[model samples]
Target chain A: MRKSMRITMILLMFLLFLLFLLFLSGCGDKIDLEEAAVPLAAGIDLDENNKLRFYVSNPVFGDKSNDVQQYNIPVTSLRESRSLQDAYTSGALEGRNYQVYVVGRKLLQHEDWFKILDVIFRDARNTVLDRMVAFDGPVEEMFAVKPKEQPPLPAILRGMVDSKSKRGTTVLTTLQDMHRQIYEEGLTPVLSEVDYDSKQKSFRLLGTALLTHKGKYAASLGYQESVLLNLLKKKATKGVNLSFAIPGEPNADVFELDRASFGIRKIKTKIVSSYSDNRFRFRVQMKVSAALTEQLFKYDIQKHADILEAQLTQQMQDQLEKLIRKFQRNRIDPVGFGIYARAYQYQHFKPLEEEWGEVFSHAEVDFDVHVKIISMGTIR
Target chain B: MNQLEKHSLSFLQFVFIIAGIQISIAVLSTPREVSLIAGTDGWITIIIGWLITSIPSFVVFKIMQRSSEGTILDLLRKKLGRWIAILFTLIMAVYLGAMAYIGLLRTLLIIRVWLLQNTSPFVVLLLLFIPTYIVAREGPKLLGRYAEVIFYFLFWLPLVYLLPMKQGRWLNLIPIAKEGWGPILSAVPGVLFAYTGFSVAFFLYPHLTNKQYAGVGILLANTITMATNLLIAIVCFMYFSPNEMVEINQPVITVLKTIQFKFVERIEVIFISLYIGIYSLVWIPCLYYMAYCLNWVRNGSGERKYLIGLLILIGIGTYIFIPTFNQSDWLEHHLTNFGIVVEYILPIAIWICLVINERMRQEGQPG
Candidate 1:
């Protein structure tokens, strides 16, 4: 009986220790739910008063009785502070900081907006990397314009941005992808610009906003050019349609590129150096796959497979060359030419850093594209 | 020998204990330091160091096999004089004791960082040591058996990390041997530390039913451990650049944190919990070694109560002395280097002296 009592006492002690450990496990105090607001998206714009205007979207829980409601707050001068640090010193409104934000689409042309991005990344409380977009006009107008029928504005925007057709070219830019482009020497940050239509009360994707090497506004690629950019970057998904022309046809032939199975087997870049004038010549060799979508010529094109292949290869090669020339003319090294040069010719690239723009502009480019038309769809 | 009473562990269990000891906190962080010294050729040094240690590990097992019923303490005393044997035994005891203490502290620190942030250090240490002491007091056979059970937990941890394998870059291990052989040669000391726990087999040698299989068991253990460590090191290098790894104190735990499961919120928390079993696998053996050494010191007639008291005191003393997480880190770094010397060099030196003593005895000469 005494021994059993000792055993019971020891067991009780062990139980107490376990309970104590459980008690000490949770660290911080519970946050008041009512005081906190979960911001799905936010927008920052410089209003006419020349003060920073912050617009936040607070998501409201939907029940059977209540339709989904979103609260929008347009606060001019987010706290009466002058400096950026002082501006946020008043603490987040309702214990929520800006989770996602949009800058005025015009601000993408200013190049100085990247400095604002650096500040956002440095903040600790902001955890959500939901979505970010650049608006064509004031960011406030874009946030104020709501969709007519949707589960929620955030969900609708998320669906549009996450859609494969829009993701790479016309959707929100992820922080990780943006950071990667910003740090890479030749690669430029391609952000999606949004324009608000007051009549439709909706947001329209205005294609890709390109940030220059110096973090300035370089140029914007329209919808067609943005799709071409996505294909070039290999970010294009399956079911993407690419239209090219047959040799003598006025109308273009469309092909649905199955990017999932597509392979860039090799990209051989050669830089032929001319020591006399310090001029560099570039030669690029690309291997890609093309799936035929439409047969422009009605005649038995199956027998003329080689002819069709040649025409398609020549057309793709011409288009790629034109795109490369456009990039060079804009003084933008979108192909990571500088990275390639550093990897191959370190000595030449060291002195060419200051004159990279001029060198890139004057460098002659030769394209050797090997487009293997694997299967001409089910038809032919 | 009755079939039912035959005291032997399966080959897998033996491998688990061996690999468990080898893949400690050292395997997680030592690769970065090794990289600093060996540059891109650190993995090569690790392979070479494993080979260097494998030779001694085999020889130690061979020596144990030659003695049917005696432990290393008995063989050492027979080969050398009593005083020298006792001296070596004391050194090994101290080394093993320090290893257990540091392992416990580091395990707690990892738990504190990854799981229990609010728990006091004393509470963490107490919770960890209580279970460790209970297992230690149970003796070597139970420790080995416990290791067999916990090995499954240890096995699944790497798979948790494999979730993020798509992000790993094979190019990170590229430009191999670009920094030359100078750093590779310098990294040998740290590389050998990962293989230190194979020496624990010496203390548990007499407990094995088939002593001759000891060498094979240890060799298999060493090979498995070296392979696991190599994979971990390569994966860590591929996941993060050398500069990024250098900034992290607990690279392995941090690497686990980077892994996100679709259903699970934080994989590191699961890793830290599973890692408790791994720590027990190492701690039990070390504590058993200390207790075994204490038994030898008492001429194998020590009271059970006295030994338990000594074990508790040692646990408490080490816990108190090595206060704070930083000191524990320092203790681990310095003791690992110290362990290589005492656990490796001292044993080989004593073995040489033992062989000489046997030769002299066979010649009928008393020096």
Candidate 2:
């Protein structure tokens, strides 16, 4: 009787398993690649009416007529905008393939706007590693720039930031990094900037956009200052090239030869933090071990190498000081000097944590550069 | 079944059982809870938590050593009264049942979020019980072997976390003990819960082939658990800033999101799916031991019957009420409190009572 009971139990379980597979397969909900509106880029900007606009560009699979579809709607919330996207697309918007999240300067100039991104971090589906690009004008203009002889705009934007960042020309920021930076009191945030020239119908990758703790745009850094910021932050290490005009020389031709250029092979930066008289001080000394990549109108290299080094050191020190003065004037700490002060002098930094940017603008800051020309490249 | 030999479990299997059970759903969020209190110095609290937990673990090992041929229930029935023994059985059965439920529910919740968004949690809970019943019916011999096999299968999980270490900043970990020892010590009670499964040693004692090495086995188990928690805590701490760490629900898997291979994307999804394999390590043993506890309550009468009955109860319970994520978290919190009473406080109280009672009885006998 027990053996028969066990046999009956096994059969019952088997029947239940079959019943489950037949009824609850969940296979009917499967979405094919073509049926899904897989967005390549997601953009946020302030529309002409000063309303927050959400945009997504999805590529059409196996059809070139509507090669890519661009849709924009004035949004009140970020994630809710995904549900309203079915108005234009054949299928629902899929966020899994987003390669870039383009931020318009108009939206970034407002205060407390970073909180709109709460859905991005809260939802598990949104990609965090997508590169974050700051567009100078409306992000719609950026999406409108469909350059010929190129890949898609999203790929171009992503590759543009990646290539410039690798060359130490701009900073590489991601959605996750920005999320980290806002909460990280030790450092302010920065993002890679891009501008479009309608006359040329091309988008240009510029330098970094400095942001305050409230996610408001503070100031902008050009390529040279961006390289200095990268060196101070020690993020970009490979292919950092710097150019300088020889001191006291004006351009004598339409093509000027007064400037010299060199690629940075090895760079080192040291910062010392001290507190005195109710203020903090940082002595930032940068040591550059460089190889000359290009030199325009240099008479002799092997002879006056020390003179060149000394001259470059003086010029570079002036430039580095100028960058620190810019940071002070803008009341930003992208170099994260606050981290050093907090780490070494905790008691003093803890009290001023709320307004470190304001206090930093009034603190004592200094910079010095040391140049060592390790090689003159193959030409010399 | 009759062909099975005495002393069926090896010493290493004994250690893996404790290690596997101790590193359950709690290890995934240990860093987050610890970071909320202790900041980046949380890894140091893990060390101190080890020192605190290993003490009680050793005491439980001592209690188990007194009765090598039987479990804590047998020891209590002999030394303490039958009523007290029954009381321990009922309390512990409830605790272990709650743990098994939470482990099963959490696995389903993760699956519902990451892998199969549309599948019902009750059906998946039913599916998990198949293996739970299969291995559990054979007793601890198969459970120990099952844990050992799963251990070797998912052994590379910790190594997978190291891939994202390159993008992590080391500055996040510095300025240790920034708030002094108060917060670090307060985080210990939280880690004490992650260390709760070591109390399972009471039932695991009789199954060991070489019972003399049980003490060393448990010490090794606590060290293994501590080392695993330390590695995960430090990795999560370094990868996310403390402010970000506190906000994430499961920073452990979230850290693996940044790792992209040429063939795969969102590796965290694959890891979360594979994590269900580890869930068996938790529930299978808890199910069997819970049955063992109730069998003791019936004076060693009907174990398999109680096992089947308990599994059915859980099956019906989940069907009637499919738990959301927050509900499972509530269950986990209550389980930790009950586990503290059953696993931590009761053993020490039992050890004291057994010591005093033995002294009086030995003095009267003059042995």
Highest DockQ against the true fold, candidate:
2
Q: List, residue by residue over B1-367, the lDDT tens digit for candidate 1.
A: 2321343555566666777787764666666767767754577887888899887887787667656566788877776668877887788888877777677767766666656666665566656655665666656556677787777646766666565555454544544664556777778887887888888777667666666677888888888778777777776665554434564456666566545444754456667787777776666677678767867876876424544665568557755764676777677678878978876776687667767777888888654
Docking class of 2: acceptable
> Where does candidate 2 stray beyond 4 Å?
A1-29, A63-66, A248-252, B1-7, B300-302
Per-residue lDDT of model 1, residues A1-380, tens digit only: 99869956885797688667667664443445654445566666676665556566655544542232333333434332223322332323342243345766545555555555553433222332435666678776666655556545566565556663354456356553454456544355666766766777776667776667655556677665666566665456544555564555443346433121222222332333322356556666655566666664453556876776676667767877887777777777655565445434546765675446556777777777766666676663
Q: Report lDDT (Cα) of residue B168, candidate 1.
A: 54
The root-mean-square deviation over C-alpha atoms between each candidate and the true structure, in angstroms, is 6.3, 2.5
Residue pairs in collision within model 2: none
Candidate 1: where is the Cα deviation over 4 Å?
Answer: A1-12, A24-57, A62-148, A165-200, A204-240, A245-248, A251-285, A295-300, A319-367, A375-380, B1-8, B37-41, B241-261, B299-328, B365-367
Best candidate according to TM-score: 2
TM-score per prediction, in order, is: 0.77, 0.94
Model 2, span A26-81: residue lDDT tens: 54447887678888898999988899998888877774634777888888998778
lDDT by candidate, in order shown: 0.62, 0.82
